[model samples]
Target: MAYQCDLGNNQTVYLDNSGSQTIVTTASGSPGQQQQSSNSFETGAWTAPPEMYRTPGGVTLKIQAQGGDRWIQIQGQSSNLSDASSIPLQEVSQVPGSSQQPMQPMQPMQPMQPMQPMQPMQPMQPMKMGNMEMNNNPMEMRMGNMEMRMGSSPQNTGSQRRFCSQCGSPVQPSDRFCGNCGHKLS
Candidate 1:
């Protein structure tokens, strides 16, 4: 039998029973790293504390496991675990007050510039058909039980239009094959 519990942020603790023995494993992923710990013990009558588990980030697990033939093992730098994992890697290099001799003096900060507002784009006027100018409206027509939708084609040089035979979707003039339905434009 195997059981697993999440300690948050991809960290997990797992318990597995193998014959007469059981193995408990804990894995935690700190800000920039990952670490795992495991313990093995025989299944026997033993006493356990009210809280028996601890994660790498000092976030305590309220588990109780007392006495048994328990063998515990911890891996990775304990100092790293005690510290906040969220600390940026760039900050790790420079200590707060630690004075290391600098090769050069720091440069002065530059002044900020005022922001300019953007101008809105002008709307496009629709093309004229015959003597009447057509408004910017969607073209809609019907043929028997089918509804026909139309739009201006930039690629089509002539008034002729093409469609996909499989799905009956419009096909571009420049394209040799159907773009929508994948059917060959014959």
Candidate 2:
């Protein structure tokens, strides 16, 4: 025997519309004015870096607002943001134990892939010493007694010191060595 259905049967399916809210805004904060964490991104100074990733339409991020500190966890098997501050790279389905997530935007699945380790920046050039030939800058070069003059008078680094080349008694600036006795006193 076949059962007969009533023609007046009315069904009103209730669909949950939760994705309408995407942008989360905290109370208008006074930026760095409010005192909380010593180094909490400077409040208003807290900005996403250049290399940041964004979640997809169906995926959602969970944020826990602690006492001024926001603790976040990457939850969502298939949805993974590589850089939420710099480069936005969407992780592929290679995440481990990534099962079919719910198509609801309001419900975000737990992240399957672990956070990627941060890489160090590379140096521009190799570290190596150059020549020792001092330049005109007296600040870099140091003499035994004679201190190079800057813009005005030539001041001696040490007082009661002979010239670079002492001859017999006092070596003159013009004479490289002493006329009577040649002596290197530089």
The best candidate in terms of TM-score: 1
Candidate 1 pairs with clashing backbones: 47-66, 47-67, 48-65, 48-66, 52-63
Q: What is the number of backbone collisions in each predicted candidate, taken in the order shown?
A: 5, 18
Q: Write the per-residue lDDT of candidate 1 for residues 18-129, one digit (tens) a residue.
A: 4454556677777899877777666543343212234363533222233434433322323333333321111123222223454587799889897788886554566544
**lDDT (Cα) of model 1:** 0.49
lDDT of each: 0.49, 0.31
Relative to the unseen true structure, what is the C-alpha lDDT of residue 4 in candidate 1, on a scale of 0 to 100? Answer: 58
RMSD of 2: 23.9
Global lDDT for candidate 2?
0.31
